[model samples]
Target chain A: MPAAPVIAIVGATGAVGVELLGSLARRNFPLSQLRLLASKRSAGREMRFRGGTLIVEELTENSFDGVDIALFSAGATISRRFAPIAAAAGARVVDNSSAFRMDPAVPLVVPEVNADTMQGDEAIIANPNCVAAIAGVALAPLHRAFPIRRLQMATYQAASGAGAEAMQELRDGTAAELRGEAFEPKVMPHPYAFNIFSHNADIDPQTGYNGEESKVIAELRRIFDLPQLPVGVTCIRVPILRAHGMAISIEFDQVVDPQVARDLLSDAPGLRLVDDWAGNHFPMPSEATGQEDVLVGRIRTDLGDPSGRTLTLFVVGDQLLKGAAQNAVQIAESLLPAH
Target chain B: MPAAPVIAIVGATGAVGVELLGSLARRNFPLSQLRLLASKRSAGREMRFRGGTLIVEELTENSFDGVDIALFSAGATISRRFAPIAAAAGARVVDNSSAFRMDPAVPLVVPEVNADTMQGDEAIIANPNCVAAIAGVALAPLHRAFPIRRLQMATYQAASGAGAEAMQELRDGTAAELRGEAFEPKVMPHPYAFNIFSHNADIDPQTGYNGEESKVIAELRRIFDLPQLPVGVTCIRVPILRAHGMAISIEFDQVVDPQVARDLLSDAPGLRLVDDWAGNHFPMPSEATGQEDVLVGRIRTDLGDPSGRTLTLFVVGDQLLKGAAQNAVQIAESLLPAH
Candidate 1:
């Protein structure tokens, strides 16, 4: 790789794709040239980037010919078809899709948690499910200090995880709801105005876990390197636009003090402590939207665990940025040679 | 007491009070007379009840005259001041506030769970917290069958739990948000439009549990007749109008089959089953709003517990009805001679 890499952002017209552009520009990433690629429908669309307009081009097999780093934010089908081609063309791929996440040969990474796991020579690095990525940032520090034995999570996911259209669905449906007008949902299977439902992902009849919940469970285990780590999560979509929030209970191998865990999280990279007992303040999605750092708070010993080995925390992160686009960009940054 | 009791509703203009009137009407409650009482501000306001408009009378020391049963839905301050007065005035009081909930002498009842705890002669009966009441209904049958060993909950509470004004605040703020206008929240501590926040209840510095969480913990233990039940709860307010939803993990004394739990819940009173894995349908706040039964679903073995003794459920209930008004009316019904 050269001192400045030629970067390409796949699905540039989508939600995370737009954020990917902002992330690269905001970080002032060392990119020799930038290419924006999307579907045929979105091709030729102009998007503002770094005080200039970049035209979206239709993605083709030859799109990554001279690109050194390719960020994939399109869905899994597109990633499955094109990521390997990009990789074979000598471009390192950071895929923000489930296409290669669970593959044993690929490293599913939350850069803050497992950047070193990236061998640098791998064809593609996988970004985890949004819940897994957000939770991993907050859980990794404590899990490292005291090995985690069990995990429980209840998520308040946002519409952005479903993609850009769902975010617009939330806004439009909410406006219609306020006007006492009927809205037939087009993107979401259920109502999206001032309401919440279990994640729209199809449920696995055998396990009773939705597709999103299953992905979070498997991806978290991979990211933590705890192959057999038990995880239970309920994924629900609230009416918010972008950020996701969750209540997580982490059980360690032995009794752990909440204050000790709080101290550890305070200094952890990619985390900002928002826990304030006196102010009745903790991680909130309204504050987490558009922010790079995951907000971690409500840190306390789990009252559900009699042995006192568990701690409960509330975490919030931008589903588009930290959970997808920003993390994918960070993985590309790890390929740089300055270090 | 007379064959047809004289029922008095305290704070009749409030959210739960309005629902209390509807609950009584829908059940065709036997009553000789109905008295509607409220604060001086709401006094003289006309509210439709049963087919006629009842004029709200200012609640005073003498408001309970000739009243056989009094249902209180005002805040704790009013309950603390007026509940005993009504009791002393020869009325059996069912209070929907926290004033007397933790009192050893007061029976904190979810009628479906612990109706027998209230002796007909008791001066006052306390209703469990909204979350506790809704959870108690779904859990009582399961706990009776398997005996719960541990409990953990993460709540998606509604604006109605705070009261009528908060609900209006949510609608107003959300409308302003849709219009791209500014709205300073008047009732909630945080922005209420398309946002979620930790329950605005004051935090208990020592335990890091907010007031709502503490109430659920204490009240659930009281209702379940388990003094030492380890309970952990996180209460959050989503932007929904009335119904509250929660994801709960219940650890039982032994390995229990999800099918067995499903059978028990299907037959349980005050609950409606909504678990449909294939159709991707589960309990949702939109469907639970104004519904009589607490919708329970998403029942499965908790993968986080390797012991196989834990099950997770998603529960949703109307915050104003079962959470407060309906439970209070049910307690009053248990006082009737036939019951």
Candidate 2:
């Protein structure tokens, strides 16, 4: 890239965008210049970076003129329209939308799982879905030891996955619920306070799987390089703010002992074992809110199968951190030469 | 039975006890008298019934002297202590606790599933756990169409299952969360506001299954009369007030069509089909709360199995109504001749 890359954060006013700024600062990503870009509505907004104020400018084709790296977290339509322009302008684009993830030409990178697959010479790199990123990081080590044959997942997702407005909606809805007042849903389709439902994403008419669940399955397969791996996912949105939790069951080609899996997960990168059976503490969303490492626990043999080839566990990870912003920052860090 | 049996309600001040009173009144059970029984602390409390006030009496050995039917929801300790005394005093006891559920001597009854197994003359009848009861009502219809060979379940349980104090703890916890204050949990082990956790039950170290999960598995096996059927369950407590939801995957010996399952569930007793695919609405805890029937939807073939023998669905039910009090009252009603 440049001697020290000039970076631009598209959609800098959104949830993941705000987190991207914090992640770059917290991780101390080496950069000579930082640019904040957003829609016209947030054009005049000021955000602080490295103890200095930076004014957000309206994103346009000319916004990537001198930028060496652009991190895109805007909606898919915006990314699809602007990512190519940024790439053509000689800036490397790391897109956080689902638009380019399934493209054979694009490399979906988690950094922890498949950093080598990302070609530095490529103009754009795609980030996997939040659920996929979290699950891929936790499942990679185990899959390396014993290839996973099948996976069944049930997700308890938080409001941040939808966007910052959805998070505010959850807060306002819950406050109204506490006040015994009716709060009509604006961001989400249903009442989100003190209630849980299947993911609000559109369902596949033939399969009945929602968009999030389908994305998770496809992204996990692509990230793991297991094209034929069978995955069944049911995604539900719970009334939480930031972190996402999943209950997963995996069947391996060979019989795997839970202790062996636990030992492997304990030493795995981007993961921490929080399984304290006696304490009745496992991976909960509240404890995983601001943590970088995904918390994993409740490692046990699946009682449904007697063949010892199945294992079940629960995992939680910060959706804004490793699920999006931190992962994107890590990919950027992987591109730079070792200091 | 005597003309209009004299009914006694044990633990008349608890969460399920309150629902039991409403259910009895709503169903208009033919009763000559209603006796409210609770601990000495609540003995003097007066509750309204049939537009008249009844004084709560202390639950002593002599509380069942003239009672024809006794409904016990106090707890296992209280049920174990006094249910036998009531039965020996010539009253049929319907216990809503884990105390006698697995006892071969006591018939575990869910009127919708296995009411025929219950003999009216039996001195004691045990109700299934709330999770088991809800799952039973939803799964019985499907299992009958095609025998289920394997089952996997993940539950989203509510606060009322833990009792009235725990429900209040949730309410207060939410209010404290809204105020940005620290809430030290008094009824639950963890902070339950906008958080989810593994069921707060003692884990079986050898199996890694908690008590509630184990009870659900055992109760399902007993109710279905499939002694060797395998069930894998992970029970979680969510931050909802009343209803419980479950995501279930079933593997059958033969292929099952989703349309068949939907039609059967719609016609089945104690279940309401809420699968609105076009509207993107399925069973939700908020809709299931205070509803008599368990809501079932999101039925589709399991993508993990190519054999076409597996299906997955979602369900929600009011824990108090069909899960606990209503089912117990139905058992009591089964004892009386037609009005």
Against the native complex, each candidate's DockQ, computed on alpha carbons, is: 0.87, 0.81
lDDT of 2 by residue, B1-339 (tens): 876899999999999999989999989988899999999999999998889999999999899999999999999999999999999999999999999999988889888888888766799999899999999998898888799898889999999999989998998998999899999999999999889999989989998999999999999999888888888888999888899999999999999999999999999999999998889999999999888899999999988776878899999999999889999998898888762
Winning model by DockQ: 1
Candidate 2 lDDT tens digits, A187-285: 999999989999989999999998998999899989999988889888999898999999999999989989999999999999999999999999999
lDDT of 1 by residue, B1-339 (tens): 777999999989999999999999988889999999999999999989889989999999999999999999888999999999999999999999999999999999998898888766889999889999999999999999999999999999999999999999999999998889999998999998989999988988888999999999989999999999999999999999999999999999999999999999999999999999999999999899889999999999999999999999999999889999998988888888777
lDDT of candidate 2 at residue B122, scale 0 to 100:
90
TM-scores of chain A, one for each prediction: 0.99, 0.98
The ten-residue window of minimal lDDT in model 2 chain B covers B330-339
What ranges in model 1 sit over 4 Å off?
none
Worst 10 residues of 1 chain B by lDDT: B113-122
What lDDT does candidate 1 reach at residue B308? 92
> Could you say which candidate leads in TM-score?
1
